[model samples]
Target: MMKIFGKVAAIVAGSALVATAAFAEDRKSYPAPKDHPLSEIISGYEFRTPETRALQDDDFENPAYILLDLGAELWSTADGAAGKSCASCHGDAAESMKGIGASFPKWSKERNKAITVEQQINICREEQMQADTWKWTKDPNMLGMTIFVKNQSRGMPIVLDNSPEMETVRKLGEEVYYTRYGQLDMSCANCHEDYYGNYIRADMLSQGQINGFPTYRLKWNGVGSTHRRFKGCMKNIRANPFKPQGEEFTALEAYMMYRAVGLPIETPSVRN
Candidate 1:
């Protein structure tokens, strides 16, 4: 009788667990329409430029290119206690580092955390190069170096490797992507995916690609990093956004890059 009772209990517990999991899946939230100018612009139907049209080959010739050149020089120069250049460690980014930038915000088993490529760069400096780490978004050296490295992967598809370890980071990123926040109550996907190719005020919406980020924005009248673009979007939603280099932004970027998989990198892209 005890054995039979134990079996029944086990079956009941299994059923309950399954039910719980189903409920969790059903509650999964995604961005939806809310009353706001931005939200209306996103969901309202109107034509806009395609991703191909927003990009121009000449975009690289601007001042951003000059900064990129400086970054390359810094990359090859020796620094740190070991007197090793970033190149000495990572080797030629054009070849060795191809398709790398798009794979960032990966789960780090050693640290038991999700880490960004910027974080990994600093980690390498601290461990391999015996150098001081750069501030998250403050260090020009870090920004320049990262931009220089990312440019090496230009035209490569944004492919992010997935693993069990990356599940948490990916989920967090997905949550951010779909969750409505800020006073406007809008998410990234609401504009880019569901309402892509629509008009938002005078500006035309593209596919909202991230592979070409760290791009040149006509609105900014200059080239800016991906984080800058991110903050702008968040602010449009009226959300108190995190710092560009913070964890929230990192996860969001990871999610964006993952979605852009197979899309070629288009550094220094032009936007209206």
Candidate 2:
């Protein structure tokens, strides 16, 4: 009976060791490679190749073009007791909207907080237009209007002002970008920096540029806003994602757009 008990203990210990080893192996197996390194796990999902770059520059139109047209109409149409069109308040979009997107996710002195582009739009709706606040993500008018507004600034260089006021917002964005989180225990840098250009099971990595967003993804079968794409990436990491147009994501988008300072806008680009 003593010998049998001893054998059982040894067997249990051995099994525990094997289990530990398996867990370690599983952890390492994340971001699995298609090749040893440098090869994409998804062979075709590589970054904008020169060919794709050309496509980004080409004047290929999208059915979603109508979305922008509608937004432009909304911008000019007056509403509420204020009897103010968005244009009546802010004037023509070119002068009124220049550098707005790039400068957003910035600190707002009036609110004493950071403000995203969406929030800025809402502020105008409430304070200037005396209009009801638009809901986020689900509101086609809000999303389409913001997208249209942003498109007006296409090709403008990201020009977020670096000031003492923005110091805290900038730092917070940097912290979020570098901190490891979720089941995979990876930061943005792990995939974008250390493993960039390497295959993760099947797809090649790009420089992780956000400049080309509101992109037309093949997987989605249509164009998607940057916030939508951001949620997908957060889901891939198994992290609980923030709401689209939420503060965290707004900060992240600002940071990422800053990173891709020179990459041109690639609205409606095809990607895997």
Candidate 3:
């Protein structure tokens, strides 16, 4: 991912160099050195304090485990107009959902669109269970159910499909991440991509990888989905945010996940 970041920085640096040609000796903010040390690790977890890491490693101590339990119960709870449980169609999530999370933000040929795992859960809820779609941030179960399913793929490397449509979606994601918005004139790339190791006041900025979500945040005292996090980021940036789980955010989520291609799955994780 740093290689990609390096490429982006080089372009920006080159442009600046051209604009200030006369200040050849005084030009500043060169592209990140090719050998930036932090580039080697993708997940922000590697950057967390040891105490934070320990919080995630211990399942019993992890606040997210509480949500995971909630997810498990809802998996078998009858719901919707049809009053069917998830177990009705898909038995034992451990068996049925192995590596499922690692393969999502994918093109669902049946649905004819790309979907996150959260969306897949809603599809099953609406189609098979005849239920209403879960609201992104409002529905607590949405995050938990996603965490329960994603935990099955723990430690697995993320893998995405290489279909043509997916390639197009990836481009859209790239556009969104790089496009500056809000009064600050910042893009996702500006903070996470360009200055990942930098700090903002008391908060340490991270690469903002999603392998950890539906993660337990000490801030929220809860597990939340990527879209929830995205909503927060948007609000902070002063951008008019898209609806969570909406198509635009889904595209951005897919791109972010793709950027984290080789990272291990660490759902139910703890982060600052």
Candidate that scores best on lDDT: 3
lDDT of 2 by residue, 60-166 (tens): 54444555566788889887668898888688987888767655667788877777777888888898888888876545567567766777667665566576766
Q: lDDT values of the candidates?
A: 0.67, 0.64, 0.81
Q: What lDDT does candidate 3 reach at residue 117? A: 89
Candidate 1: which pairs clash?
Answer: none
Query: Which residue runs of candidate 2 sit more than 4 Å off their true CA positions?
Result: 1-46, 49-55, 265-272
Model 1: residues with Cα > 4 Å off, grouped in runs: 1-55
Model 1's TM-score against the true structure: 0.73
Candidate 2: RMSD to truth: 11.4
Candidate order by TM-score, decreasing, is: 3, 1, 2
lDDT of model 1, residue 92: 81
Candidate 2 backbone overlaps, count: 8
Q: What's the distance in Å from true for residue 26, model 3? A: 34
| Candidate scoring better on lDDT of 2 and 3 | 3
> Ten residues in a row with the worst lDDT in model 2?
36-45
User: Which ranking of candidates, highest lDDT first?
Assistant: 3, 1, 2
What clash pairs does model 3 have? none
Tell me the spans in candidate 3 whose CA falls farther than 4 Å from its real position: 1-41
